[model samples]
Target: MSRAGSRDPALPARPRRTELALLLAALVLLALGFASAEGDIRGQLSGTVALYAGALAGAALALHTALRFLAPWADPLILPLATVLNGVGLCTIWGLHRVSDPRASEAADQLTWTLCGIALCGAALAVVPRPRMMQRYPYLTAAAGLVLLTLPMLPFVGIDAFGAQRWIGVAGFTVQPSEFAKILLVVFLAAYLSIKRDVLSLAARQLTIGSVKVFSQPRMRDLGPMTVAWGVAILLLVGTKDLGTSLLLFGVYLAMLYTATQRKSWVGIGVAMFAAGACVAWALFGHVQRRVTAWLTPFAPDTYEAEGGSFQLVQGLFALAEGGLTGTGFGQGRAADIFASDSDLILVSIGEKLGFTGLAAVVVLLFLLTERGFRAALESREIFVKLATSGFAFLLAFQVFVVLGGVTRLIPLTGMTTPFLAAGGSSLVSSWIIVGLWLRISDAARRPEPAAEHGADAATEVLRLRSG
Candidate 1:
């Protein structure tokens, strides 16, 4: 008979049934959404529906096949969840396109970018056979990230649009490098913290008022790196004039630091620093002041007519109000009336047409993705993988919060795009790449132990029992 506790070595058929099923479901849901928006709203069928569906299905299949063959043990939920979210975005954009500029083919462009992003994701998986290998180049990745963040400010190459110089133009194409910078910076922090975590956690001073200890604070010497990080964030704000990305980068750093050191005091310090910086920026920058004014009193005529007016913000709120409970139903809503409906105000558009029910579903999907990233981090064997995965998760969570909160007027409108659901090619591509990295890390964390190792342990146990 077979040896007791021995396992099959013939590569277990991880056929990924769950992924295939979910992909099919996502495709059907997308098709139904397109049909509803087209037939119910426009009262006719368009040729582009078939084209969009075919492109999405093909792109999803391509990525799915790659993961199955290359990273079979990868988290099955990430790709499928991304597919559903991307599909919803495509349908929504297509619906918006019908009203905004029917002839522009922006929906088709989004589909093309989605394919490119999937291809890039596949390349990432192929390039980094193991996620742990990335720990080797923390500083190099950090340097590259900084360079990318600074590129959009270059004299000739930089493109100024929507009051922020956050994109670089090359050969007629504009690219936002900040999206990719988030990933590289996360990598750097993960590697850096993996080495310094023990020291940072242990070398903290406890503070007390009289009898009760308030909190444990890091040493003044240890504060140098965080202070430097703060300066870099401020520089990013001043240089690019992009508050969303600057906030995102800094929020991610703070989260990673806390996760590494497990110090609640870091949270207090980071918040205080961010608040102080925001006050300074508000006082110094006209644009910052205008955004705050708009958020506070958007309906005021004076605020409404300014350069960066509250017109868009007020309109987005009206759109959401129009959505109400069940939404205006696909294409029936006036989401297109709002500026940048497919990007900065996408949540508003989604809220308007899909209503509270649909919007809630979307939010749940986002949180689910974040949860998977956190799960990967927890399961990871190496400290670097854990911190990196956690950072990526926090990045996604914080970004979604910023986008949704801004659109709802809970916070000043920051020019940030909703991931996967937004119109920007750079944002879409970078989101996919982050998902790819999460999958790689999850695969490494969850892969089955070698049969030899298992058998060896069983044999050792049996020998001990025999001796006893």
Candidate 2:
């Protein structure tokens, strides 16, 4: 019998057949949806259909080819899953165009954004060949993140729409700075936490509610980081009024800290701080108060009609109810009736059209994506990589929960977009960049160590010298 430590035969490199098949299936589904929605396969194919189909196919193939060569050991399902969801979203948006407004170019625009997102993903993979190198610039990333987060609050460039200053206008293009800022923020948190994990885990104080010892708090120095994070979150609330982005960034920070130290005390402290901050915002800001009130009493007539009230929330709930089982079948439901069906409420539109079954599939796909990220985190050799990958994974999971939970009336609406399904260039691009990071990290983590190669090369050199 072979010993456990003995080397086995080399495994063949994966050709990614599963990924290719899934990609083809996703493209087929997109074409089918377009054909069905238009009711004219021949004419649509001769014009607009060909353009989107070609673009998606080319983009998918380009990314796949890059992965095949650049990162063969990376998880295969992630890219294809994102592709399928994105394609379905494009189809759904295309269908909603007729119902919401004819001549709307949302689908075409989304396709262009999708292509741009893929291009960015490729660029990220090329630029950041190794995930470990990112750990060297924690301060730089943190400073850049702060700048990006603050950009949308500037008077000259910032645009206030829908009662929130969450966008900056640049050259006639509106960009959501918080979307990209979150990525930079996560990287900084990961790098910082990896270095301070030991110091943070050290208990500075023991607290007891009554007789039972509850939790141990970190030192004053350790507390400084959490304070800064909380202050930033509060600033975000006061400045941009974007509860979702603030909550997301702060939540990611807390999670990474806890993950680094395995300390429940940190989470408890974070939650308590969040609650306090939330109460203060509720007391100080009328809009924040209105949101809490609407969340608690959405069906109230006054609350439903009030500006920024539960009207959209009530409409979304009604739409979800209408889409009982298998959905109203694409393009059959009046999802367009709800405001912003293409962005914040895209999931509602999806629920109305495809029903619970389709929604379940989307949720499962998200879970799978998040699962892959966690797996990479677990397998990674470096502490920074582990923390960064896990933090990124949690960000995706929490954002989905926040968005879906908000629309379902399970929580207050926070005006966040569903990852790939939502129609926003900033969101789409950011999510794709996350995907690139995941793939790059996973490839590095899973690829066999080079010790064996070095050993083989040394033996070859020795043999050549002896023969000579």
Candidate 3:
């Protein structure tokens, strides 16, 4: 029987040590932060601590309750990893808020968003049955995805953000559809590619390359759907000015396709197509030109005037440059006064305050998560599971590469948040939700006997006897 359905008896379930440790460490850091900021806030620590503590407690309870029920097969580390990173982010946000921008109490807002994201991750973990089930709803998922991708297009619904309409205000709260759309698209792509991988792998004539055989380019039968999908994505992104999401999604599609087939040729073709697409975009799209120019020379702060396009990026570099090694210290950054501080420039603020060490720690956490995710993918038995999970890893790696590189001037400005660490409802929610899916896949691919394995020897012996 699958571990999910096991009627294991004599087991005394409790929180994993890692979960407890995470909460304890987070609570400690949170307490220290509150104490340090007590004089500044003036008798507000009691209230603020109560609020934040309550939120953490509630999030932990919800997550624990979820693992006990829905995804008994899930990894114990996934939720805790998310909680730790997000908790640190919000705490740091609050710290920055205390000094940098007193008018902006981003801590409270970040806490609220973290709770929402935790709730989302918990719910998804609790009831997502299996990651494979997502394949059944590709059409619905894809449609919803398309609507989100087009949302920034509607002036009424979309918020004018960094010259890109990436947000929608519902009632009063803002949401980024592209964040959620990326994951849904991954599901759709996994479903589509799993079925298509075999055909694409088998149907082709071989050509000799330096006495080595290579498959020629895909025929019309092979190219039609992939081309159409690519065109649709490109059209929507170029039209709406959502290049970051578009490039991230397109990169994911190519990575998944190659993973599904183990073909170097597909990657070569993808790179060629990307170069071609970039050339076309640069010629036709003026916005692309500005972004590229800024990426190449973000240090040109004088050239980045109000009328120009590189202001955000130039300011970002200034923030990073100001933050040399040990940082300006928590709650002691000057960059928060800059426009869009909470969104695209959060990383810069982090660099200014947390220094290179803090920045490196955040990156390392992400690297660890990616490593775990890729390991999960490698261990997966089902092709769909492997492709989908690998896609998750690839998406994180590439998205980080995009956003961090953008802020650091390694690439053009994408204005996207640093996943798990950046302050955005869209980024937080989508990242946690993807973690849930990755956890589910990891659990399914591995952990065949979870509840049983976690149980005490005495309890297991009793259960074994009872079963016998």
**What is the descending lDDT order?**
1, 2, 3
- Candidate 1 per-residue lDDT over residues 223-261, each given as its tens digit: 565456446744875688988888888888888988998
- Structural similarity to truth (TM-score) of each candidate: 0.93, 0.91, 0.87
For model 3, give the 10-residue run with minimal summed lDDT: 7-16
Q: How big is the positional error of residue 425 in model 2, measured in Å on the Cα after superposition?
A: 0.4
lDDT digits (tens) for residues 1-468 of candidate 2: 033433333321453666788788888877776776665212343356667777888998899988877877777777888888788788778778765676788887899899999988888888988887888888788778888888877889999998899899988778898888888888888888887888888756878998896988888787677457546744864678888888877788788888998889879988998899888888888888888888999999999999999998889888888888888865567678778888999999888887898888888888998898999999887888999999889999999999999998888888899998999889999999999999898888876554434578866764553232
Write one digit per residue (lDDT tens) for candidate 3, span 1-468: 424747444231333445556666766665665555544445445566667766876786677666766655555666666666776677667766666556675778888888887888767776776666777766677777777788877878878866677788999888888788788778877777777888777676667789888755656587576567656866787777788777888888888878777777878888898899889889987778877877676556554763546777777778888888878765455676776666677778777776788778778878878887898888877677778888889999998898888887777777767788778788988888888887777666654443554568856764563232
- Cα lDDT listed for each candidate: 0.84, 0.82, 0.73
- Which whole-number lDDT from 0 to 100 does residue 311 have in model 3? 79
Q: What is the lDDT of residue 413 in candidate 3?
A: 77
Residue 133 in candidate 3, Cα distance off native in Å: 1.1
RMSD of 2: 4.9
